[model samples]
Target: MVWRALRPAFALWIWLAIGLAPLAAQPATEDTEDLLQKAMKAAVARVAPSVVQIETSGGSDILGSGPGMFRKGAGPTTGLVVAADGYVISSAFNFANKPSAIFIAVPGHKERHVAKVVSTDNTRMLTLLKIDAKGLPVPVAAPKKEFRVGQWSMALGRAWAGLDTPPSVTAGIVSALGRIWGKAIQTDAKVSPLNYGGPLVDLQGRVMGVLVPASPRGQDETAGVEWYDSGIGFAIPLEDINAVLPRLKEGQDLKKGLLGIYLKSTDIYSVAPEIASVGIDSAAAKAGIKAGDIIIELNGQAIVRQAQILHILGEKYEGDTVTVKVQRGKEELTFANVRLTGTLSAFIHAYFGVLPVRDDPELGEEIRYVFPKSPAEASGLKPGDRIMKVGLAGSPMQPFSGRDELTQLLDALQPGTELTLEIMRKGAKKPETVKVRLGVMSDEVPEDSLPEPATLKKALAPRKVAPRQGPPIQPGQPGPRPGRPQPGAPRAEEKKEQPKDEKKKAATGLLKRMTPARDHEYWLFVPEDYDPNIAHALLIWLHPAGKNKDKDTEAVLAAWEDLCSENHVIILCPRAESNAGWLGSEVDFVQQVARDVLAEYTIDRQRVIAHGLGIGGQMAYYLAFNARDLVRGAAPIGAALSNQPKDNAANQRLSFFIITGAKDPLAPAIQEGKAKLAEHKFPVVYRELAGSPQYLDAGTLQEMVRWLDSLDRQ
Candidate 1:
C-alpha cells in the first residue's frame, strides 16, 4: 500500500525532470505533449466523482459595498465531498448571503440532497455541510511533503449543470508553498467563484488542496474575492483541513486565534516583536504578558520580526495552546500552555478628560480643554495645566514630554484604572499631584466654546515689528511697508520663476479644477498661510448627488475657509464623474486622491477625516471602513450607515462623528447606526439638529470642527 501511494509521486517527479531537461536531452515533442495532455484529463476524471454542485436559493442581492463587498450569483457553486457518509466542504463565501435553502448534487446521483451547514472554520473561511446521503466518493489527499513549487496541478470544479457533464478543469503549476501565512498554497491557475470549493489535484489525481479566496490583510469570508482570475490564487492544503476536521464535525465553529497585543510599530517586517499594549482581559494578558516585553519565540518557533510571529500564529485556532517566550530588561521569560481565545473584550478607549494643546509641549502636555464631569474635572484639573508626569497608583511616575507620549501611557491602561498625575498650574510655583479614575470616552459635545488651539492662538496674537532701517526709498520706488504689501505696487514684477527641479510648488488657498489623474477632478482648499512645519488636518468632503457643481464647490469653500485656517485643516472635495451620484467603484479613485494629498502635504494622520451628506455620506462610510489605514475619523452628516462597521481595534483606532436633523428622514437609521458603532466599542459623537435640513447648520458645523480637532485626544 505504501509503495502504491509513493509510485505516483515518483512518476510525477520523473515526468517533471524530463519536461525541464535541456532541449538536446528532451523527449520527442509530440510524445511529451500527448502524455501531458492525457495525464491532465485522467487526473480530472479521477477527482470528478468527489466534486459536487451546490445551489443556494433566496438571499440578499449583494453584501454591502466597497473593497470588501461580496455579490452572490444565481448560478451553482462547487464543493468537495470529504467523507464517505455525505460530509462535504465548501468555501464560506458561497453562502455569505445566508441563503434560505441549500441543495447539493453528487456526480451520477439522479436526486439532489438538501444540505445544512454543520460548522465553519472562520480562520480559513471554509464551511462544512451535511446531507442525508450515503457512500459518497472521497478523494485521496496528497501528502504535504510532496508539494513542490513548479509542480503541475489541475483545478476541477462541478459548477456546470447536468449529471453527465464533465468537471471544468484549469491546469497550471504551483506558484508557491506555505503562503497566506502558512495556511494556504499559492497557484498560478485561475480560481474564482466557479471553483472556490473545488479540489486542486496533482498530476496523479490525488487532491493537493481545496481552492478558497483568502487575503493576508483581511479575515472576512469574502476578503480576497477581488483577486479572482488574477493569476494569484489560494488553496488551503488538505492536510491542514483534515487535522481540524474532527472539531468542525462536532459543530464547533472555529475562529482565528488572537494574541491581543498591539505592536509598537506598524512596519511588521523590520520591527522586532515588541509589545506596545496588551488588551484588557485578553488571552495574552491572562497569560501574564505585559507591555514593553519583546517576544522572541512562539509555539516553539523563533520570532525575530513581528511578521514571523503573525505567520506562526496565523494557523492557530481558538482553544489551542501556545508557548510564548519574551525578553524583558535583563531576563527571558517563558510562558507555557497559553491557551488562545477567539474573542477579546472589545477595546473601550479610556478617557482622561482633557484635550492637549497642539504643538505646545515645551513644558509638558499642556491642557487646552477639559471635559465636563470627567476624571480631570472631578480632580479639579483645568485648562493650561501642564501634566509633568503620570503613572498608575503605587507605581513609579514616569515623566512625559508631549501628548503623544502621554497617550501611549494612557492607552496601556483600561477604564476604571486609577492614575496619578503631576500637574503644574498656569501660575503655580510647584506641581501638585492628583488622583483620578479613568472613564469611558463620552459621546456628548461640549456646550461651551472651546479655547483656540495653539496654532490659531499664535496666528491671532498681535505681533511687535521693529522700526524699518533700510536705505531711504526714492519717491517713485516702492516704500518698505512694515508687514504689509502696498496695493497697486509694482512688487518687483512678481517673479514667476520656476524652481530648477520643476516640481510645482503646492499652491495655497482655494484651488479649482485640480486633476490628480486623467478623468478625475477635485477642488482643494489649503490655508493661505499653510506651513510645512505645522501639521494640518485633512477633511475629505464628498458632495451630495448632483450637488458637485462649481457653485456647490464655491459654497463649501466659503463656509469652511475661516474654519480650515483656524483649525489648521485642508478641505478636499472630489467630484464624481457622473453628477447623478457616487458609485462603489469610485472608492479607489477617491482613495488615490486622498493619498496624493497626504503625500504632497504635511497632514496630521490622526486627524484625517471623511465628511459628506446624503449619498456622499454613504460613500464616506465606505471610504472610512475600507481605508482604515488612512482615515482615522468619519463625519457622516444626514447619512445613514450603509455597511456594517468592523470591530474596533486598539492599533487601528477609528471614531465617528454623526450629525442628523431631528426631523430628517434618516434620523432613525442614523441613530441606529450610531448605536451599532457604540456597541462595537468605537467612540462616537452623535448630534441632532433642531429641524430638518439637508446640510449642517453653523452651530453644528462648528461643533463638528471641534470633534475633528479632538480626535487625537487620549
Candidate 2:
C-alpha cells in the first residue's frame, strides 16, 4: 500500500516538472499542455454541481444614483450550495438592491425553486439564502493554511442559462493571502459580477474561496466593484465561511463589532494605539476604559500599532467578548470578557461658543469671538476674556493650558453637562468663577457679519504689489475676457525683472500648471503674505464638468482672494483628466495632491475640507465618505449625494455643509440627501438660496468661508 501511494506522488512530480520547465532548458511536448487543460477541466467538473444560477427582478437601488455610480447588470448571477439541506451562500452585493423575488436553479433539477434570504454577514459582505430542497451537493473546502501563492486556481460560475449548460471557468494563480484586514484572499483570475458569488477551486477540485469584491477604504457592499476585471480580485476564504455557517443558519445578521474609541493619529502603521476619546455607553466605556489609555494587548495578542487591533477586531462579530489590556498612565490594567456591541450612541458635539485666539502663548486661552446667544454669552463671557481654569461641577479645577486641552476635554463630555470656568478679564486683577451648561452645536450659519479672528502680535513687512495685466473683472461674475487664453490652450510665459532690494519669498498668488505627476496638473492660490509660522486651513476645490478651464480658476481666485487672506486658508484646485466629467478612478489623484500639500505646508489637520460644485460635489461626497481619515468636512454646492452615508463612528468624525438653490432642479434630492445624513446623526449645515443659480453667489460664498473658519469649534 505504501509503494502504491509513493508511485502516484512520484508520477505527479514528473508531470509538474514537465509542465513548468522553461523553453531554454527544455521545451515541453503537446502532452504537457493537454494534461494541464484536462486537469483544469476536471477541477471545474468537480465543483460545478455545487454551483447554482441566481436570478432576481424588481429591486430598488441601494446605492444612490449619480455620475460614476455602480449599476447592477440584468443577467443571472451565481451562488454556492453550503449545505445538503438547501442552504446557499453568495455575496451581499448580489442582493444589495433587495429584489422582490429570488429564484435559484439547482443542478439536476428541471424547475427553479423560490428562495429567501436567511441572514447576512455585513462584516464580510456575504449573504446566506435558503430554498425548500433536500440532498444538495456541497463542495469540499480546501484548508486555508495549505494555500500558497503561485498555486493553480480556477474560478467557476453558473451565470449561463439552462441547467444542462456547464459552468464557465477561468484559470489563474493565487496572488496573495490575508488581504483586506485578513478577511479576503487575492487572486489574478477574472472575477466580476458574473463570477462574484461563485467558487474558486484548486487543482485538486477543492473550493478555496468564494469570489467577492472588497476594499479597505470603504465598507459598502459595492465598494470595490469598480475594480472588477482589472487584474485585481478578492475572495473570502471558504474555511472562514464554513466556520460561521452555523451562526448564519440561525438567522442572525452579523455586524462588525465596535469598541467606540478614536485614536490620536490616523497613521496606523507608525502611531501607537493611544485613545483620544471614548464614546458614551460604548463597550470601552462600559468596561471602564477612559481616554489616554494605550492599548497593549488584545485577546492575548500583543498590540503595538492601531492596525493590529483593527485586524483582530475585523473578524469579530457583534456580541463577541474580547479581553483587553491597556496602560493607563503608569499602571497596566486588564479588562476581562468585554462584550462588543454593534452600534454606539451618536456623538453630538458640545458647544462652548467661543473662538480662541490663534497661536496665543499666554498662560490662559484668550477668547477671540463670542456668539450672540451662546453658552459663553449667557455666562457673561466677552471678547478678550482669558479662561484660567475649568472643571466639572463640584470637582477640582484643572489649569487650562492651551486650546487643544480644552477641546479634548469638551469632546469627551455630553451636551447637558454643567461646567465651571475661572476667567480673568483684560483689566481685572483677580479671576472670577462662572458656571454654565453646555449646549448642542448649531447647524445654521451666523446671521450677522462676524468679527475677524485675533492672532498673536507680530511685526511683519509691507505687502508687495504686482501690476495688473488685464481688465478688471467683477467678483463672482468672471466672464470670458479679452486677450485671455481660452480653455485647454497653452498660455504664453512672461518673464519680469525684479528689484535689486526685493527679498526672495516662496511662490504665492495664482501658481499655475503644477504637475505633481504625469497627466495630472492643478492650480494653487497662496495668500500674498503666506507665513509658515502660522498654521493655515487647506481647501480643495472640485469644479463642475467642462468648467475646469483657466477662466474657472480666475473666477475662483477673484471671488475668494479676500476670503483666503482673511481666513488664512490655502486653496487647491485639481483638474479632471477630461471635460466629460470626473471619474471614480481620479479619487486617488485628488487625495495624493492634498497629501503633498499637507507635507509641504503647515496645514491644520482638523480643518482640512473638500468643497465642490455640481458634478464635482459628488466626488467630494465620495472622497469624504471613503477617505474618512483625511477629510474632516465636506462642502457640496448644487450637488446631491452619490452613495449611501455610513453610520457615524467615534474614530472617524465627519461633518457636512450642503448648499442648493430653492428653485433648482436638484433641490429636492439635496434635501433628501440632507435628511439621510441627519438620520445617521451626522452634523449637517444646509443652506437654500433665494433663487435658482448654478453656483454660489458672493454672499453665500462668504457664509461658507465663515463655516470653514469655525470647523475647529469645540
Candidate 3:
C-alpha cells in the first residue's frame, strides 16, 4: 500500500474508504451472506452474556468525580471471569503493584462486585482474580490451531465505560497468528480498552485468545495500552491458559526447563536440522554434548530439528526424567534415561524473585553443550552426539537423564572441574562413558567483547557486515578447507592503499566500531572521496520496522550518504537487531554504538546525527528524545514524533527535524508529533516532503542532509 500522511480532512476520506472496503469486497453468493450473518448472530448470543463487563478502580477517591481521580479505588483495569465462582483472569499490567481491589460486572448484572487478585504471572501477562460470585459459566476455549486466516472473531466489551452500550461488539478476524505472545496466546482481535479483559470468541463461541494491549502499548505511546481494536488487538491463547492454569490455580510456581543452550534453526522455514553454536557447560556439555551436534531425537521421540527439541525440553520440569535418542552418522544411540534439572532460572526465582524469562529464538535451542575431551577423543565424543546421562553426578546414582540434573551438578562444581560423563557417542560399539574436566571452550566468549580499546589497534579487525551465512556441509561430507587460511593471503586493494601507520589507525578506528552480535543490520557507505589513510565520520542510520531490516537500512543510508557526500559525510547504516523488523534492542544498540564512537573518534560531536525513514524516522525521534544530550539533531523522514510517555528516559533530550512524505501513513502521527514537540517546547525543524510518494525515494536524502547540515550545537 502506497501511503502518505494526509491532513485531518484527507484522513476522513481515507477512513471512509477503509470503512467501505469490506462492503465493496462482499461475496457474490447469497449463501455467504446467510452463513456469515447467522454465524455472527449465533456466536454473539452464545458468548456475549458470558463476556463480563470489566471495570477497574484504584486509589482513594476525591470528594467529587474528576479526571485522573480514583472514583472508587485502585486496581487492575479489568478482568473476565473464565471460570465459575468468580475465577477471573486479567492483564498482569493492569494488576501490577498490588491493586487495591478490582471490579467485575457481568452482563445483565447491575451491581459490580469487588474481587481480589489471586496471583500474577508476568511471563504469561495474566493475573488470576477471585471474586465472591457464583455460577459464572467459564467460556469454552477455542482451538488455537484451528483459528484460520481471515476467520471471523468478535471483541466484546463495555467500551468507553459502557457509554457505548450493553457490551459493544466490534468484528475483525484472525488477521494473523503465531505472534510472539510471550508465553501467552497472541491473536489479532478487534479489542480496545473496553475489551481489555474480554474474551475473543470464534464462530463456535469459544475463547481463542484473550484481549490485551497490542504493540506500542506503553501509555506514553497511547491511552489504554494503545488500540485493542483497529485490527491491532492481541489475545492470550486458550492453549497457553491451559498450561498456565494448572500452575496458577494450584499456586505452584512455574519454572521452565533450562538447557542453557543457544540454537538457531537450520530449518530456515522447513524441517531442516538445527545448528548448535553456543552451549553452556553447566548442562548438556557436562552430560557430554558439544557444539555442531545435529540433535535428531528426544526421549525416543523422532525430533526433526531444534525447535522440536526446544518444545520437548520446555515441557519437562526440574526433576523430570526422559530418554533421548540421537543419530551419530550410520549408527543411532539412546540415552536410556536423563533427569531434567534447573539452571539460571532456578536461581533467579529464589534470589531476584523475578518472573520467568520469556523465550527467545536463540535461547530456545541448545547453543551450548558438554563433552568429555579425553574420553570423547578416545572413545569419540563426536559433535553430533547427544548426552543421555551422567550417572555419577548424583548420589544413590539418581539418574542423570538429561541436561537439567547434569547442569545442576556442573553448577555445583568450580570452574575447570572434572566429572564422569556417560555419553552415547556416534558409531560407537558400546556406550563409551568416561571422565573429563570441564574446560573452557572458545565460543563461549562474547563476540562483541573483542580486544580491549588499546591492544585492538594492532589486530586486523574486519568490520562485521550483516549478511546470511552459507549452508552447513551435508551429513557425511567433509567441510571445504575446514579453518586453514592459505599462506600469503592477498590483501584487498583498499588495504594496500594505506601506509603502516594509517593501517594501524584504520584498525584502531575499526576497534571503536562494534556492532551487536546477533542480527546486526545496517548500511555501510564508503565515502566518494574516502581515503584509506584517513578515517571518515560513520553516521549510523537506524530505521523503524516496516520490511526487512538489512534492506531498509541499506536503502535509507545509501540515500543519506549520497546526499551527505555532496557535503562530505561518511555514513554507516546499522540495521536493527530484528531481521523481521525494528525491536527495542535494536534501538539500544544504535545508541550504544553512538556512545562508543564518541569515546574513540575525534569527529564533531555536534555533527553526530541519527536519522530514519519511516519507523526509522520514529526511532530517530525516539533517540533524540532518549539521548538528546548525545544527539545534535534528528531527521525523521517518513516517521513523526512518538506519543509515548515523556517520562520516558529518551524524551528528555528529544530534538528533531521532523520529515513527512506527502503520502506517508503516519502523516497524522508526524503532525501530532510536531504538535507534541511544540507542546513540550522542544526545538524542532519540520520538513514536509512535498509530492514524495514513499519513504525510500529521493526526498529522503534531501531531507536528511538538509536537516543534519542545519544543526549548530552552540
Candidate 4:
C-alpha cells in the first residue's frame, strides 16, 4: 500500500516542479518612489511662490447687536494667487459677513497689504480676492471641462499644524476626480483646517485644485500617536475657477443658463425621462416641456447617463442656444434653438464688481419678469419666451443653448453692441425673432440690496391661493355656511341661511372669486378670541433638535397651549425641512415665513421673539447674530453656537436665555461664551440642568417654557 501511494505522489510532485521552475524566473520592475518625489518637489517649487498667506481680522460678537466692528490680522489661511497682479482665490467659509480687513502675505516679502474681496461664488464655495501687488506670477489656467483620475498633484499653503509655527507645505497625489459643486478634489495630501483656501498644484507648476477639508485623524500623531493621513483632501477644480475668473476679474456680471425643468433618472436604457416637475413657470415649462417627457439627446448627441446633464448645462453661458430632443410616449419630437437664460449669479457677480451669471434653480422661465433693463429686455424679449439664436456683431448667428456656452457668451460680450434674438413662446405657431442692443452693465446688484422690502415682498408673493380644505364646521368656529359658499371657495353645496341680498349677489358673481389676493397667507395657530384689529405679539419658536417630527409637534403644541393660554401670543412653529433640520434652508425659509406672517397678520415687530431648543437653539443663535434687525430677543437651550465669529453690535442687541446641562462638556464653552458676550453688553440669563443635558424633558420643561414666556411679558 505504501509503494502504491508513493507512485501517485511522485507523479504529482513532478508536475508541480515544472510549474514552480518557470514562475521563479520572473523579473521585478524598478522602484518609482524617487520619480514621484522629484515630480512633487518640482510642482511645489513652481507653485509655492504663487501661494499667499491670508490673514482675516473678523469681528467677534458678544450678544445680538447690529453689525459688529471689525479688527484685522493674519492667522493661517491659504490662497492661490491666480493673476499676475496678485489676485488670490480662497474659500468663502473663511470670510463670513463683511469684515474690515483681509490681507495676503506676499512670498519672500515681510509686507502685507490689504486685499479686496473681488467676488464670492457661494454655490462653488470659493471667493476671489485682489491685492494691489504687481508682477506676481499667476499659475497656468486649466481648461474647465476635464480632469482625469490618478493625476499627480501637490498642495502648498501656510498650514497651521500647531500653535508653535506658521503655515507650511504638504504633498500627496490626486486620489480621485469628478467631484460635485461644493465638493473638492480628493487628494492624498495632508490638509489641515489651517490649509483652508490653499491651492493644489500639479507637476507643470499649475493649480490643479484648492485645499479644503481633509481627514481629521492625523492631528494626534504630533504627540507620537499613530494616526494616519486620510488621503482625502478636496480642491476646487481649476476648471470651474477658470470658467468664472474672467467675469470675476472684469467686474462684469455673469449670467448662468437656466433650464426650466427638474429631472430624475429612470431605468429606461435608451433615454432619460423627467420623473416630476418642481414648478410651473420654470424654464422647462416655457419650452413647452412637461413632466414625464423622455429626453433622448442634447445638441444632436445622444445622452446615455443622467449625470452628464447638469455638467453639460451648468457650463453654458447666458444667451447661448441649445437643441434638445425628447420622446413623449411613443412620439418622437425635438426642440431646437433654445436660448439660455441668465439667473441670480449674474446679479450677485455684478455686485462684487465681478460680472458672472449665477445659476439659480429658483429662476425658471419667469426670469424675464426680473431682468434689469438689459439688452435682452430692450430687444423686446418677454418672460416665458424661449430664445433660439443669438447673432453677434461680426460673427455668424450661433445656436445659444447649454449653460457653458451661455455663460461664456455673457462673459465675452462688449458693453455696447447690437444682437439679434430668436425666440419662441408657448401658444405661438412660429418663432418670433427680434433684435436687442446689449448694454455696458447687466442689471446686477449687491448683497446689501437683497433685503429691500419691495424685493422681499415680491419674492414672497404667493403664486396661488385658494380656500383650504378642512374638517366639518363646529358650533362657534367659522366653517362653510350651511347655505352659502365661503369666499375663494367653489359652490359645491347650497345654503339655507343665505340672506336674500347675499343670495342675489352670489347668483350674479358667485362663479368668480375676487382676484386671488396678491398673497396667500396661512397662520399656523391663532389664539382663542383673537381679533384682526388688535395687534398681537408673535413668537416664532424654532423646534428643538428632535421636535421636527409629528410626535415632536404634539409635545411642543401641548407645552405651547399652556403658555399661549395666559400670554395670548400668536405662536408660529414653522415646519423645518427634515433633511436640513435647522441648518439647511431653515434661515431663508424662516425669514420668508416671518415676512409672510407679518404681511398677512398684524404682528408687533418690536415684540417678536425667537426661541429654540438644541437645533432650534442653534438657529436662534444664527438669526440673532445674522438678522438682528429682524428679531427682538432669543432663547436657546442645549444648543451650540456656530464657530464662525459674530459682530459685536449684533451680539449686543441680542438678549440670551441660555439653558444647558451641568455635566455638558459644552457648558464650559458656554461659560467662556458668556464672558465673551459680556464684553459686548449683551444681557444673558443662564440655567444649568443637573443631569443629562440633551433636551427639555418633563423635569425641565416648565423652566424652559417660563423663561421664553418672560421675554415677551417683560
Candidate 5:
C-alpha cells in the first residue's frame, strides 16, 4: 500500500517539474529600489521651499458647531504658498479654532511674519492667507488628465522641524480617483493633522493635489479629522482648485447646488433617480420637471441609479447650469440649461381644501369634506365626488390618477394656476371634467364647521369623565355635587358607583420619566393618567440654547404637565450634543426619538406636535420642516423659521400655531416667516403677544393644548 501511494505522488511531482522547467530557467530583472530612493529625495528637495509652517495662539480650545466642530491640536500645521503675490493657502481647519494671533514661518527664514486671512473656500476646506512679502515659491501642478491609480504620491509637511530642516514626507501610491463624489482623490499615504494643508506631489515633484481632512461620509472641516494616521487619505486635485481660484479669491462661500426633488425610493442600489416631490420654487420645478420623471442623464454622464446622480452633481455649485435628459413615462425628454441655485424662493403649497374619505383601500379617494371658500367649493366639487384624473387639458405631463399623486401634482403647481379635475359625483353616470384654479393655503385653522374625527370619538365614547377628588364624604357630610348623595352615607344612592378602573391608568397628571438611546440623548415625560388604549398627543420640546439642561427638562415638564394630564400629552425634550448647541444634523436624531416614542407608546400621528421656545422654538421649526411626515402641528414661541422650507402638497395638511412678541428682537423675522408660510397656504394660527413673551401664561398653555387636540380635525 505504501509503494502504491508513493507511485501516485511521484507521478504528480514529475508533471509539476515539467510544467515549471521552462519558466525557472528565465533570467531575472535588475533592482530599482536604490534608483527610486534617490529620485524621492530629489523630489522632496524640489518641493520643500513652497511648504510653510503656520502657528496660532490664544483661542478657544473648541471651534465652530457641528461639522466645523474642532478640538485644538497640540502642534502647528502646514500650508502651501500658492502664489508669488503673498497669497498662501492652508486647510480651513488650521484656523477653525479662531486663534487670536496667526504667524507664518517660511523656509530658510529665522523670523516670522504676521499673516492676515484673505479669502476662504468653505466647500474645499481651504483658506488663503496674505503676508507682506511676495516672490514666494509657487509649486507647479501636474496635469490632472495624466492621473492614474498606482502612480507614486508623496505627502510633505512642515509639522515637526524648523524652516531650515528638511520637510517630513510619506510616500505611497494613488489608490483611487473621483472620491467624495468627485471632489477628492484617494491615496494610501499616511495623512493626518501633521500633513493636512500640504501638497501631494508626483515623482517629478509636480503638485497633484492639496491635502485636507475628508471622508466619504461627509464634507466638513473636521469630517475626516478622526481618521488621523490612517492609511486612507484624501487630497483635492490642484487642477480642480486652480479652476476655482478666482472665485475663492473673491471671498464667495461656495454652497451645494439644489435640485429640490425628494425621490420616491430609498433603495440605494437599484432605484433610478425618480422624482416623488418637487419643491414648487425649486430648480427642478422651474425647469418643468414633474413627479415620476426618471433622471436618465445628468450633465453629460449617464445615470442608472440615484447614487449615480449624486456622484455626477454632488460637487456642483449654485449658478452652474446642467443639461439633463429624463425619461417621462414612455417619452425621452431633454431639459437643457437648468440653472441650479443654493437658495430658492419660498415655496407655498397650493390648496383645493378638500379632504378625501379613506373608506376603501381599493378605490380612488372620494371627497369627504370641502372648505366653504376653497377651490374645491368654487369649482362646484361636492362632498361625494370621486376624483379620477388630474391635469391640464393639453399638457406634456400625463394626468395623475392616484389620490397621493394628485396631491403631489397640486402642490407642484402654484396658486392661481388652472387645473382640470375629472371627478364623478354621487349620481353622475360618468366622470365630468371641471376647471379649478389652485387656491393659496390659508394660515387660519379650519373653522369649527369641519367634521369631527370619527376615530377620536370612538376612542373617547366609553370613558366617563372621572369626578374630581375631595375628602371622602363622611356619614353626615354634604355631597360634592349640588344634589348627589354621599358615597357611604346616602340612602337615596341607587347603588355604590362601580369602582373606577384605576388599573387602566391613563397618561395624565404629573409627567413620568423615560430614557431612550439615540444620537441625541433625550428625556421623556409621559402624563401619569395616560391611557394605553387611546392614542395620545406627543410634544417634542426644543428650548433656547443655555446651560443647565437638567433645569430645562424640568421646566418643560412643569409647563405642560397639567395640560398634558387633561389632554393626554407626552413631552420629549432632546438635549443638544454639547454646550456649543444645536446643529442641523441633529434633526435626524430628533426624528429617531419621535419614532421611538411612537413605537414604544400609543401616540396620535395627526396630533404629533413640535413645540419650543427661544432656540428651542427655532429647533422645533427645524424639526417640523425636516420631519414633515411625522409632525402634524408646529407651535413655536418667538422664533423665526430656520430656513425656507420645501413646499409639498401632501404635507399641505401641516398646520402651524405661532406666538410672536411684537417687542421681541426676532419678531419681525418671525412675522415675515409666518407670512411666507401663509403664502404657501399652510394653515397658520397666529397669536400676538403684547410684547415679547417672558413666560407662557397658564391660559396660553391651555390654548396651545387645545390647538394640538384640534390638529386632528378634518
Candidate 6:
C-alpha cells in the first residue's frame, strides 16, 4: 500500500537522477558502487548550503551525559536551516549544557555567526536557533507518507570537517517507517552525536527527516544515542517539522501533549486501553469521560491495545485537538475537540486527616481514627463512622468507591474546598450527609506508632517459597561454560520448557553484584526464600558520601536481611561514583539501575522506596522528585533538601518519611524540608531521633521498615 503511494515520488527521483548524471542501462560493475557514491555526494551537495556546524562555550560538562545512550563527544553538534531568515533547527542536545554563547558555521560562509535558541520542541527533541544572517538556504521537505522501507536514504551532518568537503554523509536505505511511535523515520545509516541535527535526504536532495537520537521505548532526547554509528538511527520527519515551524517561529516551546489518564493495565501489548483513573480536572474528565471507559478510538484510528494509544499520541504536542471515542457500557461516545495540554493546573491532595483501621467491621469504608483538629473531626465525624457515600454539596449522593477514589477526588481539590460526605453511624437507621472542608495534611510523624503488624511474621513463617537462584540450566545445556554438557543431558526436543519469566530472571542472593556499564555498579539482595509469585517491595539505598565503603556492603546485607525475610522486600544498593558526594547528574545513572532492577524483579509498584542517608538522602529526594512514576515513597535521613520536589506526576501520589536526629545540625534543614513538602500537600511523616549521629538507630530502622511496609496501604 505504501509502495503504491510512493511510486510517483520514486519515479520523480529516478528521472532527477538521470538528469543529474548521464546513466545507461549497463551490467553491474565495480564502478556501479562508485556511481552510488557520486549520487550520494550530489545529494549532500544540494543540501550543503543549509547544513551548519554548531559550537558552544562556557557550560559545565554535565550535559554531556544522556539517559539510556552514552555520547562520545561534547564539542559540537549539527543544525539545519528551516527558514531563509536565519531560523535554524538543531537537536536540543546541542544547547543542553546551557552554554553562555553559541556560534554556527554555515556552509559557504567563511565566518561564524552568533546564534541563540529561539524555541524548543521537547516532544520531538529539537531546538530552533536564530541568527542575524538572512536569506539562508532552506531544503525541500519530502512527503513523509510516501516513505518506503528500503528506499535510498542519505544522512548528512557537519559534525566533522574535511579539508575541502561539505558535511560528512552516510548512505543507507530506510530501515523502517513510522518508528518511534509514528514520530520518526528509521535508517540504518550510522547516526552519531556529530550528525544529530542534520538531514536525512533522498536521492534528489529532498529532506525526508531531521536526524536525531530517539527510541521507540523512550521519549527523551538522549534516548537512542547509544545506538549511534551502530546501524540504527532515527530522524524526525521534515513534514512534521514544517507543520510546527510557525509555532517555533513564535518562540513557544512545545511539550508532549497529555490526556491525563492512567490506564488500568500494565501489559500494553495485550491489555485493552481502559482507564484505571482519570484526572478530575483533565481533558478526559472535562469531556465527560469516566475511569471505566475503554478508549476504543483516537483521532479516528482504532485503539484496541494500550500500545496503540501510545503510538498514536506519542508525537502530539500541546494545543492539538484529538477526537476520542470511548466505550462506556454498550454506548460508544465520541468526544470531539478534546484539546491536549503540556501542563495541568497543580494538583494538591487535600487531606481530611483520618487514619482508617487495618480491617473494616462494617460494609462501607470505616474510619478507625481521626486526627485532632482535622476536617473529619471538625465536621462532627468520629471513629467507627462508616462512610457510605461522597459527593459535592447540593448534588446527588454516590457510593463510596474506597480510599483510592476518595484520595483521587481529594487530590483534585484545592485546600478549603467544601464537599459532602455521607456517614452511617453505628446502629443508625439512616445516613447523614455532613459538609466537610478539605484541609492540608500534617507532617508530624506518629507519636507512638507500632512496627508493621504481625502479618509480616506470618509471611516470614511461610509454608513454602521458591529458592532464590538463577534459572536452572536445561539438560545438555552448555550454559556459561561453553562446550561441556551437564549430566543426564536431554536433547533440545526433550527438554521441558521454562516459563518466560524464569528463563530471563536476574540472579538473587544476599549480595548479587551487577555492573550495568563501565563505571556503574549495583548490588541486589533477594531473600533465600523469595517467592516469585508474590510481589516484593524494593528499597534502594543511597549511602552517604564515600559511604560505599568496604564495610557498607556487609552492613547492608546484615541490616536488611531480617526485615527482607520478615516481609517481601528486595534491597538494592546502587554504588555512587567515589561516594565523594552525589551530583545532580547522578540521577540518570541511578534511575537507569533502578529501571533495570524493576524490569527483572517482581517489584511491588506501590512499595518502591528510595532511602538515602546524609548527602545520599539529598540525592534520594532528587531521585524521587524526578522518578515520580517509580519511587512511591522516599526516606531521606539526616539530610537537607538539596532540590525542591516536583509536583506529583498525573494521578501519582508520593509520600515521604523524613528523619533527623534531635541534636544534628541538619535538623533545621530537615524540618524546613518537611514543612515545605507539606505545604505542597504531599504526605510527610517527620521522625526525629534522640542522638546527634547522622544515622538511624536499630529502633529507627525498625520503624523505617514498618513505614516502608505500609507504603502500599490504600
**TM-score of predicted model 2?**
0.86
Q: What lDDT tens digits, residue by residue, belong to model 4 across residues 409-503?
A: 33223335465555677568897767665554321222222111111112112122212224211111121223321111111221122344643
What is the C-alpha local distance difference test score of each model? 0.77, 0.76, 0.46, 0.50, 0.67, 0.69
Kindly list the per-residue Cα lDDT of model 3 for residues 1-714, writing each as its tens digit: 001111111111111101212332232344554455466567656765666655555543431111111232232244566677778777664543344656777666668877776765443456777778888877788876677766666766544434223345566556676543232334444455545666777767787867765442232212235243344677767667766776677665444444544333223235434333223443554554433344677776677655566556644555566665554444555655565545431111000000111111111111122222323344434443434434233311122212222232332233244445454455666754555544321111111211111011211233222121232122221112222221111123322334456634432211113365644544345445543322223465665465544454455554555555454455656655554445443556777666555443333333567766655666665566555446646766776554432421111123466667766666776787777665544456666766654564454445445444323210
Q: Model 1, 231-302: lDDT tens per residue?
A: 888899888888999999999999988888877555579867777678777888898887767899998888
Q: Which ten residues in a row are the worst by lDDT in model 4?
A: 218-227
Model 4, TM vs. native? 0.43
Ranking by lDDT: 1, 2, 6, 5, 4, 3
- Which runs in model 2 stand beyond 4 Å of their true positions? 1-34, 61-63, 66-68, 361-363, 457-504, 649-653
lDDT of 6 by residue, 512-548 (tens): 4556456777787888887554557888888887678
Model 1 has an lDDT value of 0.77
Clashes of each: 0, 0, 52, 62, 17, 1
Query: What does the lDDT read for residue 432 in candidate 1?
Result: 94
Score residue 639 of candidate 3 by CA lDDT.
68
CA RMSD, predictions in order: 11.5, 11.1, 18.0, 21.1, 16.5, 11.8
Ranking by TM-score: 2, 1, 6, 5, 3, 4
Q: For model 2, how does the per-residue alpha-carbon lDDT over 346-430 read when each residue is reduced to its tens digit?
A: 7777777887775443445788778778988999999889887777776655564355546655655668888888899999999
- Candidate 3 has an lDDT of 0.46
| lDDT, candidate 2, at 168 | 76
Q: What TM-score would candidate 6 get against the native? A: 0.71
Q: Give the range of the ten consecutive residues with the poorest summed lDDT in model 5.
A: 11-20
Model 6, runs deviating above 4 Å: 1-31, 64-74, 215-231, 276-281, 354-373, 376-444, 451-537, 542-550, 561-570, 573-605, 612-630, 636-647, 657-703, 706-714
